[model samples]
Target: MIEILMWLAVPYIVIGLVFSVTHPDDVRSLEKQVQTQLPAGADALSFGAATLLWPMMLITGPVEEHCDVG
Candidate 1:
């Protein structure tokens, strides 16, 4: 019975590990998206802010209408 239980648990453990490491957020893609939405000739401050806030922006959704790429 113990051996049977271990076999059943192995697949679950493998899949969980795979999913845990596989996040969909790509940093470069996020930067490009930010650039598209930003105003022309915006300062480095704006770019820096977007770089810092990207994870939160992804979680909370875009603050501006044009921020959405698709």
Candidate 2:
């Protein structure tokens, strides 16, 4: 048990060491990929209501865009 943990921890410790050696801009880019793709402030003014009201359509497309609008 202890021997398996020692071997598993060795590479993880090496990875942590390498992460610390990485450049700051590269690290920031990595962190930014985890968030949503919204632009800075256009969401609330433009698409906030649409996004909140129709999350499914936002994720997927509309079932019929030209169906029945009078």
Candidate 3:
């Protein structure tokens, strides 16, 4: 049971780490959208939170809207 659970969790953890590294700005944008600021090492905290809560982050979409008004 433990092994099976570990297998199931691996994908989430790996993907979360990749996302955290690749889209760091998204994490900051999310913090801004939520209107909560953390003092010192906030980026690290945000990355950690994002890694754990990546599924919810995906559901919520990007925090910043990029509308091309041309």
TM-score of 3: 0.66
Candidate 2 vs candidate 3: the lDDT winner is: 3
Clashing pairs in 2: none
lDDT of 1: 0.50
Q: Clash number for every model? A: 0, 0, 0
Q: lDDT ranking from best to worst?
A: 3, 1, 2
Q: List model 2 lDDT by residue over 1-70, tens digit each.
A: 9999999877765654454344333323323432245446433322332322233433444323423212
Q: Which stretches of candidate 2 lie over 4 Å from their true place?
A: 23-70
The lDDT per prediction is 0.50, 0.40, 0.72
Q: Give the residue spans of candidate 3 off by over 4 A.
A: 30-38, 64-70
> Residue 61: error of model 1 in Å?
14
| Model 3: residue 34 alpha-carbon error in angstroms | 9.2
Q: What is the C-alpha lDDT profile of model 1 across 1-70, one tens digit per residue? A: 9999999877755654443234234333444565666645334434444454545655765454345544
Root-mean-square deviation of Cα positions for candidate 1 versus the true structure, in angstroms:
12.7
Ranking by TM-score: 3, 2, 1
The digit string of per-residue lDDT tens for model 3 on 4-49 reads: 9999999989999998778777777655544345666666777788
What TM-score would you give candidate 1 relative to the actual structure?
A: 0.32
